[model samples]
Target chain A: MPQIGGAPSGDGLQAVAMAIRILEYLAEQRGGIGVTALARALGTTKSRVHRHLRTLVETGYIVQSPESEKYRVGSRLVTLGRTVAENFDLSALAREEMRALRDTLGQSVVISRVEVTGAVVLATLPGREAIEIAVKPGSILPPHCTAQGKLGLAHAEPAVRERVLLSRLDMRTPHTITSPTVLREELARILERGWAVAPSESLLGVNALAAPIFEGGGGMVGAIAILGSIQFIEAEPSALQIRHLRQAAARISAQLGDVGRDGVDSLPR
Target chain B: MPQIGGAPSGDGLQAVAMAIRILEYLAEQRGGIGVTALARALGTTKSRVHRHLRTLVETGYIVQSPESEKYRVGSRLVTLGRTVAENFDLSALAREEMRALRDTLGQSVVISRVEVTGAVVLATLPGREAIEIAVKPGSILPPHCTAQGKLGLAHAEPAVRERVLLSRLDMRTPHTITSPTVLREELARILERGWAVAPSESLLGVNALAAPIFEGGGGMVGAIAILGSIQFIEAEPSALQIRHLRQAAARISAQLGDVGRDGVDSLPR
Candidate 1:
């Protein structure tokens, strides 16, 4: 049987666990969600979730969206985020790995953070002959198209994954995943295979491969993507290329204190 | 009567409220704290605080330092922080205000975020002939010295304020606040005045004035600083300079949804 409360079944206080999960769910929604949808996703009753939401919102861990009439992650979390990122140097931790992937794979390597709104590039290292050398640090990518975006979606919590599937899969290119059925299938493939690749999905003639970076506790902190020409990166990367990319991703994740494992089965997924 | 459980006296769940306050206290520490210190700061029993800390640590909201055995803000907060920041664009929101302040004052303007460690430049805009245009965005300033740093400290929680004063005030320059007693006195004055000034505390002949930026909820999101030579910004800003600086700060705080009031009586102090 599932645990009584919504949080993971453990020795910890159920109320606290539920509160954190509520914050996590709000974050995944990016846009926010009403209490009904939130409770349904969390596998708890509406009243229980409402109690937790009240506490979360009161502490500024979550905010009620005026337009959507749903709870979204709030600015207090943003304040804590800056404190933790600067304290731990999560972006700086990803730097050496990005440079290595760029040099070894001969493709531009980018570290993009997975946020509530979308996958935004945190930093990028250009490779030899890389076209998109100037990828701005904060550019957002469509989840249905880019390798980094897919990597994030594939590892998202079930509620979030379902919601994203139920939402619009914007067609960035002909190859982008536009159907829920197709996208679900691709996400399962990403979980099983440990990497995602896109050939002209985000843009024509551009190809990329990405692997997830996990925090020590299991959540996917971000993803490292290797970008290059369609001819170079190809429809599916070579075995050697995949091996190098995975190594670079694992190294960066290690710096961030991830469990040193990239497989979804071993992570928060 | 005080709330039986933990947390501020309110109509909400005491456990949840206490848990959130514990995280806030950790953030103010900008590092970690032992259970006793945390309990003492929150005015809760050690056992009660420990129970909450266990829940927080288990959820990755807080982590224990292996060496000091103190509980500190964890990576999960970093995760939530990222979700809040990019989702809300607190830094981006401050960027627009920086330009206006610079344009109006004819002095270089800067937006600096206050974190556990110190005050950091979040964004900057140049004046008509500002030579310090290259003030790196992430530069950290001595907390006991800069106008931005004092603005942050003046509004920090009592526990955090005491801790910062307890530490050695590094001598960045002869005029730096090197004495705990004097710095404490200055912080009280800053809280009363709603601003701070540093004449060569960071570098010789460089003068600056700063005001705190607040969110709608009365939290200090960041601070705005106007920098120039002794002739331009002045050791003590003229009534006109103070007026423009305060207006620019209030406008940015409004953008961030601060309550539009900055008296210490209304803020954390």
Candidate 2:
């Protein structure tokens, strides 16, 4: 939206610039990079490049071999990649459960993570019926108009909730919430009820129900939601369906909550 | 080893330090980081930290969310991690093949990538026997003493081979190639034979046979080798064993060679 970078903010900015230049150079080369090569490529002095590389090594952005001293990307960078890619999203952990939920309800299932801008669907499973709504993975949905979005907004921390609602609520369909007051009322109900239902809010004749996915750290991470034509799924779910959906969501949340604490994705030796 | 980064050498060094400091701070936060928070954590001025943040975002060392403008690690760092972790090693892709190779031969299998200094074993599958040789993943093997190491050296680019040969050839056992001339002769023979074997060079009564793993890019990325006690495998492989090992290595090399070109793990959709 607004211009973010480019102005010289301080001495630290120059350091950040050089460090990034080195990384950009390293990214181009698949093999290990040397200080001389980086300096030559960036049109700088070798000694200068070497000093920067040493600092990068200390911070774990650049790793140097014990014998060769050749630098490559560090394991920490990979750790960060996993963070950005998943962002506390638990689709891989909830994949099987999402499929099971879809089969049980015979409705389309969607798991989405609420981002600063909007809700991003991480994964989805189709309904038992041949005809089903297919939400592409990575597709974005308005926070005020979908079951997954409602669950996300409902469970988000107050700061995030307030910021997300600051913008005008563009209606996706006739049933979509256009008033901040009404949406806030629904969110309160969702927090108390532990789930949210949006009937024909995203698209006409479509209804969706969702449950919040929580992390072990006591934060709402995403949502496990199911939607279908009003003929199959209405605004409210059957007691049994609600239990199954919430149970699956809760189970996935529990499993993911212990990720870093229990070493869920750590190296297996 | 030499007290790497506490002392800065030049103006460029300061840039490197600031960039790395930002990365280290970013690693500590799971959510998003703003310029103001980063400056406070590092005890630097906010304007300076903002400048550094801009450089990181530009180089992909840090990512800025369009909606939040909060910085985190970018996707490119993940790409770099894959390169450093498994770029030259096919163990993960060849996992099933390695298992099959072991099952068929009833011996332990080791996969290693040969770097400038030595060979680093990426993965291993224990043999069928109760007393199978155990080679830990990430174990380093001397180039002069291992079948995988020799295979790597024999096929390496001339510059690397020359450099490795220049290093002292320490004798591991009486059978190890302590003389550079003799090792060169064996390497020449290995080039002709498409494989290499080292008998009792590493241990008193163990033998290993290795074949070079070739990527689609025409580089010998690593070696796939099988080893066991002298009683089971002996000093050299039988023609049948050689054929099986080569085929397995070739299959894995083919599968992984297209990674950089095909863009397989770029980002999960």
Candidate 3:
């Protein structure tokens, strides 16, 4: 028999587990979902699901639509979710991987979320080198000049590319690609190569090599990059650097539910 | 006196409640928080708190720091939070207020989140008028022109304001504000007056009046705006219109935990 209410079959926190599953399912759904539907989907009795739904509604984790009388994720849950996303989660997920990347390459690692205006820095790990690129968690990297930005552009939807290209590409440095045609060509190559690089583009003496991180179902969620002085990293990045970067990205992607075959073993030599 | 489990007390979902409290507390905290500390904070025994933490970590809602062994929110929680924010919560919170505003004014009402690039439209209620404003969800309002954008700029941090002003402000219409000095002056006025208006700025013959929506700590979370033909929503809106819009914003803000004295009752006549 299935365990219920600390029945000693297992940890007996099955009620909490059920409640979380209901929430996760609700988050995935579009509109109001009724108790019967939720019960059927979760493979539980209607009464058990109903009790949990009532508790959730009381706690403001979910709300009942006034008109439909069906349930949906509520404001309090959304607020908690926002707090986790804003303060902890993404950077937390990348911390170990970032540390590993930095240790392997002796280069500063930067993680960025692909936002509308630019690739916004989410986290950064300092390198072993004395002279390091000074990028923080909130820095916005220009699309035409940074490795992460270019990778984001390469994987972004067509409309996103159109919007970025339509805007005036500000020249951050002498080597920055301000022309739409040049940037477009670079983005195309980056897409094909599965990685990106920007040498002396955003900063005169800084270079970065990046690869795309994917969420489940193959959507590009963000970019992971290694930052260093041009003395070590060049416009043409070393194969070792590219491979390690891609591998790191792939591992993070796997943890994020992207279990596709295009992982480390599938990389082209 | 404190309820624990399904004893002769209210609701009897104390275990679930305690689990949620732990998650919420962890979300509010930075870095890892220990079990002893959490137990102390919750006024519960160490063993009881530990059980819930184990279940939470196993479910991936939170994780134990490998080195510190303290707990924090995990990737799953973050992913769920992003899903809720991107798909439902803010719009859901504004729906009732938006509907009320539209019913009162017969003008289209738009809700927008202040993002890095611009004020992003989260939801819209079509006006009662036959010829309604055509703005929809996901539309990006240009910072120099739209009422929502102006209101967002007024409440934004100094760095955010500087970034928008430093960028080339493309004029959408002849009346669109392009000069940084002019926009800066307008923003100052908006901040002082507690609202914003843009007439024939983003689009000719189109106008919008907007008010900021504040969160718990009075941080401007987003904006609520009324959109219509310039003939209806004039550059100088009617007092009736302004009061209604501000009231709607206030009520929504109040629901979001901004229970300060500066609410509907405190508005200037």
The DockQ of each candidate is 0.20, 0.12, 0.17
Q: Judged by DockQ, which candidate is best?
A: 1
Docking class of 1: incorrect
- By TM-score, the best candidate is 3
Query: Could you give candidate 1's per-residue lDDT for residues B1-269 as a string of tens digits?
Result: 32113535683667778887887777756445788888898998999988887777667776554334666665678766665554554467677767877777788888888876678887788788736533678898667888988888888888788898898777877877788899899989988888899888887788889988876457786888888887877777898788778877877665543445443222221
Which candidate comes out best when scored by lDDT?
3
Model 1 pairs whose backbones collide: A81-B81, A215-A258, A216-A258, B215-B258, B216-B257, B216-B258, B216-B259
List TM-score per model, in order. 0.50, 0.39, 0.58
Q: Sorted on DockQ, highest at the top, how do the candidates line up? A: 1, 3, 2
Count: clashes, candidate 1: 7
**What tens digits encode model 3's per-residue C-alpha lDDT throughout A106-136?**
9999998876567999889999998767698
Ranking by TM-score: 3, 1, 2
Worst 10 residues of 3 chain B by lDDT: B1-10
Better of 1 and 3 by TM-score: 3
Candidate 1 wrong stretches, greater than 4 Å: A1-22, A25-54, A63-75, A78-269, B1-9, B12-78, B82-88, B130-134, B262-269
Q: For model 3, what is the error of residue B9's alpha carbon versus the real structure, in angstroms, after optimal superposition?
A: 3.4
Q: Candidate 1: RMSD over Cα atoms? A: 11.2
Give the Å error, residue B85, model 1. 5.1
